[model samples]
Target: MNFSGLLTLQKERVPLKSIEVELEVRDHVATVVSTLNYENKKNKPLEAVFVFPLPGDAAVCHFSAKIGQTQIVAEVKEKQKAHEEYDDALSSGQQAFLLEESDQSPDIFSLSVGSLPPGESASIRLEYVTELAVQADDGLRFCLPAVLNPPFNPQYKYRGRKCKSFEVVYVPASWLSYSLSFSARVSSPRPISKVESNCSLDPLQYLNTDQTQATVKLAAGHKFDRDVELLIYYKDAHQPTAVVEGGQASAEPGTLMGDPMVMVSLYPEFPETVMSSGTSCGEFVFLMDRSGSMDCAISKSEQEETRMSSARDAVLLLLKNLPMGCYFNIYSFGSSYEHIFPKSVEYSQETMEEALKKVNQMEADLGGSGMLEPLKHIYNQPCIPNHLRQLFVFTDGEVWDTKDVIDLVKKNSDSHRCFSFGIGEGTSSAPINGMAKEGGGHAQFITRSDRMQAKVMQLLRFALHPTVTVTWDLPKEVSVTVLSPPIAILFKGQRSLIYAQLTGQSSEAAEGCVTVKYSLAGHPSENQLHFSLRPAEDTGLTVHRLGARSLFRSLEREEREHKEHEDGGVKEKLVQLSVQSGVSSSFTAFIPVNKDNGDTIQGHFLRRNIPKPCEFTGRNFKW
Candidate 1:
């Protein structure tokens, strides 16, 4: 059958019935457990495939399914081998479940359940751990994806089973037939101040008198149309703290999981004298995506505000408010790239007007989103003297070659700092956040509900000054190793996370101190944080898993750098880490098997693609 016919048939028979989510936040890291219930309401046996979204940086640690009275556990295996096993099992009439990440985007995942008998139900549960991203307002943000709006990528192949050309029909949020139940428990060293959400939530419940622990849940009635976002605020949220977690007892000694670990949270606050200082000059490059998908409405209910128009408004705001005397240029890309000026020109009324005029006339006529050439062109330009170079990128983040773009940004990081903005719903978090991380800058998301002016102003304010660089000294006997990214740039009131393995043994009563020193506006400031050497009770290996994930990310970056010189060594190491830590990666997948010896059905079973409900208008959603 053709793709549309198949989609029509699948729409008539929805496989997913309900979803439940449980979350636990300890310090800065969050562990999410999601359960999806599926029923075969059809008269005959069938296979069901579902596609979903997740945070790009999440480390999926567990996947399992319960069929009837039997609970089947999934094991991590190489992606290709797992697919082969799944296909073989399906052909042999054995029940199987396969889960894998999307090759195009890091935030999308595909799950397939095979050989389900008639009138049977399967409850699949998955768990992942990820660090919470700090919002521009200094609140910790947690997002539960409710929509996976596919991006239009005519040039790229769609490897996932749900969509043929990245076209997802938008279903309104109020029209969801299935309900969702979500709850979260948050524990931190600081006092809990308040919890805010875009969706309605029950009253917060504190677990203790000090208010260090709290729990919150979605109210009884919530429409599952928009993504659920939680902005958590804490008393003294900017104050730094250090936590020590004990090693896992079941793991080998001296390894990453076997050793005790220390995590230090740094909130660098320079003196007022340093804060008042500002840079007099800088080079600003604005790169905007004018791809065809930018023509789509920013939200299903809001057809008037297209992504292209919003971006143009944002660019105009930026151009009008740029620092006087700074050099700036604008570039737009679709299938190809073009720049408004041949070279960086000083920010003046005339120059700003010229740029604004061109930007206003721009349209989403570009065929595809190819960012490499424009980036290469920007980097190849000579650096103007005494000007701090900052590159601001605005896009829906629809590119398929995410890794290559990130690697390019990482390679040119020393030349310029990058500030990225994701402009639409379901924008791939990989490129937006990845570029910021590699280029030593910040990432901001602008959705239909968000005000473009506020976010753009925030970026402008951040770009007005150079990022603060912080360094620290630890005890000599400790010999600590930093597992997370090194502190390259520090923004005031922004949280800096440092994860390290404490290798040497210390006395229980011993206290280790960390002194963070940084220079801002030519002034040197320092903050000292002292933590006890005693390890806290075992946290069920949460810290170890997070550390493993950090290690895996670093190793993957190194693998990309050594792609030409390496001989599969990095892949081997990645496999070992993934298998040992029980975390999913680009190289690994989760596959569950059902060994029940029921009578094998001789007839063929139909396949069904379960669609998630999202906001949609009468117009077909293209991207």
Candidate 2:
């Protein structure tokens, strides 16, 4: 089950090695310039071409790249408004960065690798300008959308969904701690039913007590730090979700229920950051959910070993790829659990032999179990960066205390980013997504064992980002509407980020009034300072993705739950989303939507029923 069997090496090798994006904000619009470096690291010769998904509608300017004799570069000039929400990103998923919900429009876009000689690297640069339309709302409330495609809007998706993103130069300043806080202040107040906190989720819930604000006064030479959770949430009305508080409430159609204002708060202190006094190492934690139901046989498949075999192979492949300075621990759970190593085992000859010996002997036998316990243990466990703590939990869908475990992960953001790997028989994706989101982590679906290495390596590369911590600030006069949560910028790596779509405008638009905030290392006095924006061009992709990511995530949440219970409304919303993103989806595996628009492609995993608030009557979508 080594995933190499699945590889189809491209005989036509056009490799892109380096990518970069530069953004300049002027008035209400942002001028974006991008560069993609393509070079042959291969031992053979090749030719590559830049394949862009977007057509010439948005005013594009093409640049060229020369990697020795091979060259490729593409650019586009798009007009956008400052902060105007994009509800149409899904339709243009492969072309835009924001994963918004829209009628999927298929545009022929791609990149082809042509001629490349052995052992050579080339660089490419592209530049473009965008002026998005800005809408001013009285309330500081906005919805940051996400596409279940990347699980959020990534620059790339399942089948290479292209979106706007950036490449950054990460300069590591030793002893200097940096904090990154991003948010979308709603134009109106919105209520939040579920949130992560150190305290219990009770009526009188409180903020985090696990850590405290840094009392060390920061000066030019000071390196004091702590990690803070930058929460962008709506002001919620007193209402109960199905489980927490009091469980369940009715949403009267005419009754405008929850608050719409999404408050942006930097937790722990005014300026939040983290500084590690210890050396950084790479450590991997294998957290497996051994719930009893994972024993179920794959339907229509020849054997019951189908699921177990896949899970085992993936873990093994992961182990084989361990890099130097890497250490690992394995935890499996059913109603109870077992840790292969009481502590981490380095990638030494003896350690590897022993760990592999134990791994080979380990058996998959467990009852239905909970996820919270192991998560807590990992949080409390001692860890250092070189340890590179990565807990890869493989399960076959059975889970408990799902939300609670998610909260636990979020509360410990300073320590770990738990990547939830789900491989099961029709399990709901909501809880899994919630788990990753809570941990500020990532989630992936492993249906077959053959795809594990590529998937896992993708995660590894994502974790290898040079900028462990990064942040950006919106200028004065202009505001941005972040449409979605963070996604892989260039290729789903954490460093490549597209904030929720936000509006930008000149202060004069609101009779001249605006303030911007930035969380930095040395500047504490004017962190929440003011800036401005004026109108520019308007191709409208930014506005679209902002609205798209927000809407898509909500639908994805509902869709996963509907799948769990076999509801109908889930189908309807899914169809709508599929149409919006142009991806082929089923209740089974989801296909990448980059190739086709809504016209010819059709297959969806949408919800067929939308429970009328408190009542579970399942309303259907028009699709």
Candidate 3:
């Protein structure tokens, strides 16, 4: 059938009934469980496909389905094997479900429900764990994308033809055939200060007098047009804390999930004298995205500003606020790249005004998103004397060669620091965050309601701050094997997380101290946290799963970089860890089959593709 015909049929009989989400937050970590209900109304057995989005760093650990009284739990296995098993079960008249990550981006996923009999209902459950991002205001931020209302319509070529595009439709929460129910429970070592959200929410209810635990729910009749974001505030958020979790008993002793893991959160502080004295000398390079997608509005609002205009305004503000005598340049890229100056120029009134005029006149005339070549060009330039090079990148779309781009940044990290900004909804977070992390910089996202100038200015402050170094000190008896990469960038009041595996043993009453030493602007400073050596009880394998994910990403990057020299060892390690920890990875998928042979029907099933809501734009997307 044609794409338009499929969409029309989808509108006539929507299979989705409701979505229920439960979130549990422990300090900086959050665990989410979501249940999706679907019922078939047609007279024939059908297979349904639904594509959705998740947090880029999340680890999906569990997936299962319930059909009537029968329950089937999914297991992580090799991607090819999972696909074969799913097909085999479908052909045998058994119900099956397959969940796999997208090859183009980590944030997107595709789920397939096969052999769903007519008039039958199925419930799908998915669980994931993610670290809450520290916001500019010290509030931990969590977002649930509104995938049903406007839908997440990612553009991809099907059978050499472009799929029909649909305008953004605003379906009110009350008007949607599918309903959403959300509730969250938060617990922290520090006292909870407050909870806030963009959507309407019920009043916060504290579970104890100390205010360390609380519960909140989304208010009824809330709109699903925009993502549901939660910002949780805590008293004394800068205090360093450590959480130690024991490993899984079922896994091998030497495996990642079987060992003890500790997560340390640090917020570095500089001396007052150094903090007040901001550096004035630096080389600033700003890169802007001029792809066609930038022409779309920043949000779904009727009068919202376009992403291009917002980025242009932010660049103008940066130009105006730049420190005098600093070296700077401006570059724009789409399929091709253009630079205003041949090389870095000293910042002055003449240069600032020249850059501003050109930025204001810039438009989104470029055809596709191609960032690697321009980034390579920028890195190829030699650094100016006595001026630390600081790179700023702005984009509203995804690029196919994300790993290559990140690897390039890592190769040139010693000469410069990179700051990245993702503009508009549905922007891929993998590349935006990856480039920043690899380049020793910070990443920012600008949503529909965010003012680009404010975030840009905040990052500018970080750029002007003196570069800092980090050293970790632990007890002599207990050594730590850091799972995450070395600390590359540090900013005042921003949280830096470190995951480590602790070996050896200490007495239950003994205290273990960890210190972070750094030199800020030629002055040495340190922050330390002392906690009991005994691992905490009743804490699930959250730390282990997160650590596994960190290691998986590191290995994946290494595998990509050494594709010529390496054998299949790296891929094997990744698959082993993913299957052992029950976490989803690029090499593995979650597949579960209901093998119940009772009352098997012997007919072929029809395939039906469920249409997901697309954003309100017509930009062509590449996979």
Candidate 4:
């Protein structure tokens, strides 16, 4: 099966017209609303299918489509049930829309608009909320991915057929028929220092004299060729803050959405002396992707540097910067994997030279991207005694079993820290960020106009930093249960978020404290934040939904790792939370069928695929 552009049974032009995006930032959280306009120019009724990408950790809370004068909002339902409803609607000569998350990867989503009469236009609005990632320079980063290169997943089934191959068709900027318009409004408690982007933007406009709120927009006639990125900087970014959101009024009192949730942002700081004196004892393992796709140019620019070459240079820099007496190893994988040494060897001149020689000779000759085996090999190796094992992974493509890979890393998280990097455009963020979040490390993406060395060095610093532990202290009357996963990794100046369910009761004036204590280079250090129990106003259940998403992800991972015969009821729990919070999950989809008799058209429909403009470089491979 071909997983190219908007795929349809017929070979007609795409029906998608334009896309409009509106972004609203409330401090560290961002809410995005995207409207996709489509029209059926064909003579017969049309059914259009469009597959797209989203941030891996985003919580998709709203989906609806407006057909002419009527707007039909979708409801979260079980995946199978939703599909059945959609199919039933289509069979009965009715209008229906279905939005489902990919079974293999959460970042990929498929939207189906069925039974649109000829010459009719429809507008689809999708809304999602995500926490902005904190960059090394203390900027809150947000990206709107433009490329639609579906990852190569061997087990991925499209329209009930297993895909034999995956190919990315790059449509040049000049050939793009669709247009995009974007604007953003940012509000923060602290002063907004500045707003920057890779794409040209209008001058920032502050709404208030305090400089806490601002607005910006993308330049007119901007080409949708690459991912649109925004870097927002705020004064005193390291100051820890907590936002408490009230529970949904309609939800059950004891449930996830029914109870108030608290989101705590913590930034740990270590002593200057300890940070300056980095550790010299640790085990560093480097895993590089040598898939055929890595041969593509790193970006759409005029530079000739392939992803593999840039990765090699980054690896070389890492090798030369390794502290003395540290144990290290190098491994590369494509269809198969090869290691530079039989086991991890001490960092020495001769060992470094031997690894550098093989690194320079590496090529993107591997037929397909199979990373599970190499990762297993690396994890199976016994860790050296008295040394922290740090695993650094570099990849420019996606794998078939992203959840499985993440599960494996989570299972082995206690043994090592995994730092992941995505080298080029169209790289899957699910696996890149999943491994890092689960394995207690950091994830970075080197995309257009990004220097690989700089990002690599940032991660290296995080890898060599000291390991720390977190603890919280609250008022006696108000007990807390963490909804998100435990704090696994911490870096100086980078934000670490914790979500918790605040049960019991406390006075409006009651206060709570959360402390983070860690040992840096054998020296103990701590950072603390005290906050009030009063819930933040006008939060609109954002924190509750985000907390539900975090818990849902954790439960899904547990369900995957559960034994076949185990009756853990993880699936049932996931569905309950998804439905209650109105968040899309792997088991749930947004399916809405327009029951209005006037909207129904009694005619056979032809399937049309909407073509999305992708990057200038493409990757073609068969599993």
Order of the predicted models by TM-score, top scorer first? 4, 3, 1, 2
Candidate 2 local lDDT, residue 69 = 44
For candidate 4, write residues 1-623 as lDDT tens digits. 22533434452334567889999887788888998887777787876565667777889999888876667787898877775555555677666567777767777777665567778888778899888877767788898876532222212222212222223445667776778899999987679999999899999999999998899999998987777889999998878878778787887776788778888887655556777776657999999987666766666552376677877888898999988899999999766688999999999999999999999998766545678898899889998988989999888746656777888998899999898888776666888888888888888887753556667777777643555576778888778889888775677655677899988778899888888776777777777878888877767766777788899998887787684769559998899889888999988988664545334222232222322211122343233
Give the per-residue Cα lDDT of candidate 4 at 426. 60
Q: Which lDDT tens digits does candidate 2 get at residues 1-623?
A: 00100011232324443334443322122334555554465686543333332211111223344455433332211112101222232343212111111122111122222234567665544433222211111011111111000011111111112111111121233422222122111111123222221112223222233211111111233111111111112232211111001101242221111101111212112111221222335778888754434443322122344445556666777777676677888887765678888887777767766766766655444533556677777777899654546667676544565445655665675566676665642333445555655555666654434445666665554343222222335445334443345332111222112333233332443322222333223232222312122222322233232233344444555665566788868666655543343222222112112222322112211211111101112352111
lDDT of 2: 0.37
Residue 71 of model 1 has an lDDT of 73
Model 3 steric clash pairs: 151-613, 152-613, 153-614
Runs off by more than 4 Å, candidate 4: 1-6, 10-13, 68-70, 148-172, 463-467, 595-623
TM-score of 1: 0.87
* Candidate 3 structure quality by residue, lDDT tens digits, 1-623: 11210111243333677889999888898889988887877798766554556777888998777776667777788987776555555567665567787666676666655566778887878899888877667788888876543443333222222222212334444555777899999987789999998789999999999998899999997655577889999998988888888878886655677777888887655555786575657999999988666766666652357677778877888898888779999999866789999999999889888898899998766545678898889988999988989999888745546667777898898998888888876566777877887787877777754656677877787743544454555566666788888775577756667888877666678666776666577676666788776777757887788888888888888777677986789989899889999999889987764446432222222233322222223454332
Q: Give the TM-score of candidate 2.
A: 0.38
Is 1 or 3 the stronger prediction by TM-score? 3
Q: Report how far residue 414 has shifted in candidate 1, in Å.
A: 1.2
Look at candidate 1 and give me any clashing residue pairs: 171-614, 173-225
Clash numbers, per candidate = 2, 131, 3, 1
Tell me each candidate's TM-score.
0.87, 0.38, 0.88, 0.89
Q: For model 1, how does the per-residue alpha-carbon lDDT over 533-568 read when each residue is reduced to its tens digit?
A: 788763566676788888888888878778899568
